[model samples]
Target: MPRFDITIVGELNLDLILYGLPESLPPERELLASRLTLTLGSSSAILAHNLAVLGSGVGFLSRIGDDALGEISLAKLAESGADVSKVRRARGSTTGLTVILARPESRHILTYPGAMFEMGFEDLDLRYLADARHFHVSSFYLHRALRHRLPEVFARMKAAGLTTSLDTNDDPDDRWDGELDQTLPSVDVLLLNAHEATRTARAANLEEALEKLSKRTPVLVVKTGAEGAIARRGREEYRTRPRAVETVDAVGAGDSFDAGFLHQFLRGADLERCIAFGSLAGAFSTTRPGGTEAFRDRAHFEEFFSHHSTAEADALPSPKPAPLQAKP
Candidate 1:
């Protein structure tokens, strides 16, 4: 019924990913030896890029500083085929940034909220909501300024007849309070990591946390890093093992998973398949560098997915970690 399959309205960030080894967390001085990677990393931004790679007509609305960082961000989005006109260029804020200190395939972030904190319901394109099948908002915790818009956007999305979803970044102060109950009733899904699930709703365990969230939202996806992830749709539950790959940088891994899940889901794929698809995206991203940089086109994703993920509804590969997945 809608012209665009899905629309993601949120932050887009530029990541300066610093590389190192697993022995010990590298100091800033040691970064010179490890190599710093400048790449695309954003939640709604990367997911929208992955969705565009899947050939979906997507619209994204966000604000960026009118600087090289913003230009690079726009260039990355345009190359991915996501609609770019909705991205607003601002005067002072210089786009969002995450400084990632990395190991062999994993990373630790020191993020600077920058311009991402500048977004609010004031930046939205109201008509865009009416034209999309789904509307998802994510990554507000990078800054405190945007939190006020969640209720407004959720309220508007429901009134516009758009299927809504919310994904959040990890922050104790930023975790959804009772706002989720007000927000979740309109949200069709909530994409949260194990930490967020365990922390936000204050449940004793992961399953209980999901149970509590699902009572309000229609579906819940809880991702538990290396242990894998789970998805619940009403009475049905589907689980999948993460694709075993060399970890490049865990930065944006969750966003990659979200992109993978939403891409197939927009095509109306089944729950298990969607979970599998998301796992592949999540896994493949870890095998490379940067946030969005980890993702390849659909063809590359499908190939790696087929090779790593189980073919039938069998057990997941008993992963034996050895070498990293970097194509060195």
Candidate 2:
């Protein structure tokens, strides 16, 4: 067996969430938040942590500063049972961090890319990467230093006989400029939200976006929030509706979905089952405050899984691709 089920090459950071903030912040004013929370953050880190919690042997590869914040980030990630042996500590740079001002309806995030921007293709150890059965990368836009080298990295991973996935997350610049054409072909699976899918494809709608992207990526998965998620492979497509739950926060739902999807996928589960488990995991994430909170232990994960997953759902054979239906 491979040493690890999955190896994640991505960023590591912390999220400082301040709740009950004013809708608008005026410059040069002191404001108080009714609540504050500091938790492990970054799309990649969340994915690795939650995946490890879900019983996957996960390994994380990234760079962080040799600072207190970095120490905290590393400790939190290690606490989640993910292998942090490949994580490097850069001497001069500090770890990345995001400050979130949580409003009633929406949240504003301020990010400092710090050492997250310092990692590059050179920092990646191919020997370490070879130990995993699959590879995943996230937050494409945030990795400034490694942006240009991703295609080569993906190619290397593919050459090492590893299935690969990419979650570009949100492009802060809104200019989805990268080696997507070269990179997508190497990517076995590509995960995106509805907005990201449309933006990356430059299409008018989600269906059109999937149609275009599916041509490049072998499998395309789109996270549609409460509507659940949809996936396409070749001409085949599958979708799963989200489960109803009392949502605490939607911070890392998408990453959690990725973890769920990949968890079943690594087990050789079909796409339909993967989508269902992915949706179930995404919903479970919102029942708690942070990404990995709900799956903090095996008991929580098993209890939630047992309560939410039906035997029929798990045993159902993969269904035929349904007719293309546009999002309403």
Candidate 3:
């Protein structure tokens, strides 16, 4: 058997979320928030952590700074039962950190790339990454050093006989043109939010974006927040409504959605079931302060899924046969 069900290559960092912050910040004034929660941040780490918690064997590889933040982030991910044995720590750089000023209905996210921008293609181990049933990449735009080589990474993963997925989180530069065109052809699944879909496709509307993006990958998933999520597999399309819950903050909801959808996906569930479970998982994330807090509570995690998942929806065939030995 392969060592992991899914392997991820991306960033690992910490999120410092401050609640009750003013909508607009004035330059000279001292602003204070009511509450604070420091937790694991970064889309890749969130998905890997939650997927492992959901019972999928996960392997994660990332480059981090040799700092306290990096250690804390690595430890947090390891606590999820993921293998972080290959995580690299660079001596001079500091780990990335995101400071979220969360207001009532909106949030301002400020990030210092730090070591996140330092990871290069040289840091990746193809054989290690390919020793899995699936491969996923997130925050495509953030991998400055490794950006150009991502297409090769995806291609090699596909050539190694492993399915692959990509979540091009957000483009801080707003230039949607990276190696995305080259990478899309090898991706079996493509995940995006409505805004990201529109932006990436350069479409005038969501409908156009969906139509255009669906053709690029075998499966296209667009996260719609409160409206739930939608998936397209060729001519067939599936959607699921959002679960009603008292939301604390939406910190890691989308990543949790990816985790849920992928967990079901690796189990050979249909798209409809994957979408529903994804929506359910997303709603559960909002009950806590950060993206991963709700998941950290074993009782809350199991209770939420047990109450939300249907027997029929939960029944999925076992994963497909593991991929062949990865080529060097």
Candidate 4:
């Protein structure tokens, strides 16, 4: 049996969130925030961290700079219970960092790719990768070095008897282009938000986008904020309503959903259960200022999960799978 339930290959970074900022930033003006937080950031790291917090044995591999920020990133990941022994520290580069200006309903992020851009397929250690039953990759566009080589990597992981998932976070270039045809076939699941799904499919609407993507990906999960999420598997579709919660910050909510869905998925839960749990996890994330804060420990996770379980049960019925027929 594999030593780890899941292994994540992606970028590592720190998020410095400045809260209580003005509605707009005027040029040449110095602005101050009422609150500030530094936390583990990066799509893949958040997913792995929350997955480990949810009790999965996770292994994480990424490239970081040999610097103070990199050290903090590694320490945070270690504290989250993910195996970071395989993470590499690249020389001559600084760790990636994101400065987030947090507003009431949205956030603006400025990023420095730094050493994260140095990682490529050659940097991966397959011997360590083979010890995980599953593999996941995220922030596709940001990982410039690995963009062209991911299909081969996924194929290799599959050949080594591991299931794989991909979440190509927003493409900064807006081109929405990647090795989808070559990569999706090797990926068991493709996770994306509504806008990303529509853009990736090059379609005019959500249903059309789902139809287009479902042709390439076996399982496609599209996150629809507030309305919850929808998933397509073969000719079937599964969906759940969002678990209502007071919002604090939306950072990392999607990654938290991925973690919840995968946590239940790895345990062989049905599609309905997976979607519901994912929604619940995502809702919990918004109760805190950052991605990993809401799930800082078992007690917090359990408390939120259990409390919301009852509330959600009383509010909505269990999700059911519906047949998805292509429109003529």
Candidate 5:
């Protein structure tokens, strides 16, 4: 077996979220949605778990704080069966965290990169990467130093014949200006949302955006919420709509979708099948309050999927009266 079906190196973080409220607003009183929940989050964690659920051996490289949150993060990853031998831990830093300002079916978040910033490229030991078959990177901004070193690192992975996948969590820090402009082309599979795809491709329309993205990386998948998602690999292009169901929460929807799609894609499934799988996972996530919590491995996904017919039977309704992306 390959050292790992997929190896993910990234900036890891804990999410502190408060979401869901009930009753109509009274202006001054400020109506709050009821039913709040907290769960493990962070793009890399979501990707790793989904990969494992998809039945691939996963290895994650990251840094976490020594506090309770850090402990929880590690415990959760271990529980998910991810090999954490390469995860680095910091003694005094607080685990990187983000607070989700959420409405029942929608979400808004205030993210803080706390200790994830500690996961600089200098900490990456290539020996671990050498054994991996695929490398997925989720955080490009948490570490300033890593931004410059990305090309060299990925080049090494490429040399080892690993397929590269990247999810961009653009840093609001100084590096955002054009750092990604230089970094995106080196990847083999580029995963992103519609907005991110447009940003990277410098295009306004979806098709044009996909064309631009594919020029750099052979496969590009863009998640378009509600409208579903689109993917292009060489001459292949496919899209899928969200599963229609009443949602309970919308927190980790997108990341979960990535998990589902990557699981199928890596297995050599076709474009349409991959989009269906990923979108199904995204829709499944809406039923839960957090991203990782909603993520179930292959058995769970399979069991749930087997119950439905035509795949599209999974679209979920907005659990909250309002949508998450609309605000802020």
Candidate 6:
């Protein structure tokens, strides 16, 4: 049996969010606002942390800098009950940080790539990562040094008989084509937002993007905030609307949705159940200040999940017949 239900390989960092900031930032002027929070950030870390909190056996692998920021980020992830034994520390460079100036209806995010961009393929423990039932990666564009070899990583995982997923959060460059075409073929599930889907597929619109991407992976999940999420599996399609909640911040809502969706998926739930749960998780994330702050509260998450999650059997899906392997 695999040692973990899911193993994640990606970036780890902290998000510094400040609320009550003016919408416009005039250069050369010192602007002060109210409210601040520093919490676990980065799509990979956020998803891993929330997934662990949702009772999955999660193993995380990443490289951080040898610094206090790395320590804090690592500790935060660990607090969520994930196994971070494979995380490494690069020398010299500082760990990455994101500064978010959040307003009532808008936000400006500034990021420093830091040590995250320096992590190379050599930092990975292939055996450790393969000792899992599933493998996942996030923030494709942010993985500068490792992007070129991600396809190889996914191929190896697939070869080892593990399912895989990728959530290419966003392309800062907006090019949306960095080994992505190579990586898609190995992906069992592709999770992204509506905007990301359109941008990635380069389709004229959402409907066209879904049609294009669905052919690339066995499952394609597109998260639409407020309206909920949609999923596609071959000819079948499923959609779910989010439950109403008093929102605090939406920093990690999408990642939370991934955690929820994948959690149900690993349980072998149907796509409808997965989408419903995913929407619940996304809504729950907004009740707290940062992406992970709400999840850090065990009581809060347990209660929220109990109320939203449907009562269902927890059975592993029957295994599919193995694909024919090429002669070695």
lDDT of each: 0.73, 0.85, 0.88, 0.84, 0.70, 0.87
Flag clash pairs in model 6: none
Those runs of model 5 whose alpha carbons end farther than 4 Å from true positions after fitting are: 21-33, 104-106, 170-177, 296-302, 309-328
Count of backbone collisions in candidate 1: 3
Question: How well does candidate 1 score on lDDT at residue 257?
Answer: 83
Better of 1 and 2 by TM-score: 2
Model 3, span 206-266: residue lDDT tens: 9999999998889999999889898999999998888899999998899999998888787
Worst 10 residues of 6 by lDDT: 319-328
Residue 185, model 3, lDDT: 95
lDDT by residue for model 5 (1-328), tens: 4566678887566666665544233557766645555567888887787566546677888888878888877777777778888877888778877787666455566776777766777678787876766777886766655767887787788787777778885446433454666666668777888876776677888778888778777778898877899888777888888878667666667778877776665665566776888888888777666776655444545556666435534321111111111000
Error of 2 at 6 (Å): 0.8
How does model 2 score by TM-score?
A: 0.92
Provide backbone clash counts, one per model. Answer: 3, 0, 0, 0, 19, 0
Clashing pairs in 4: none
Give the runs in model 6 whose Cα sits over 4 Å from its true position: 310-328
Decide which is better by lDDT, 1 or 2.
Answer: 2
Model 6 Cα displacement at 202 (Å)? 0.9
Candidate 4 has what TM-score?
A: 0.93
**What tens-digit string does per-residue lDDT give for candidate 2 at 205-298?**
9989989998988889999998999998899999889989888788889999998898878767778877888888889888876676777755
Q: How far in Å is the alpha carbon of 325 misplaced in model 4?
A: 30
**Model 4, 1-328: lDDT tens per residue?**
6788789998988999999999988999988899999998999899999888877778999999999999999999888889999999988889999989999767898999998788988889987887877889989888888889888889999898888889988888899876766888899889999999999999999999999998888788999887899998888899888866888888989999998888777766667777788888888888887889888855777677667767445222122212121110
Name the 10 consecutive residues with the lowest summed lDDT in model 2: 319-328
**Which is the leading candidate under TM-score?**
3
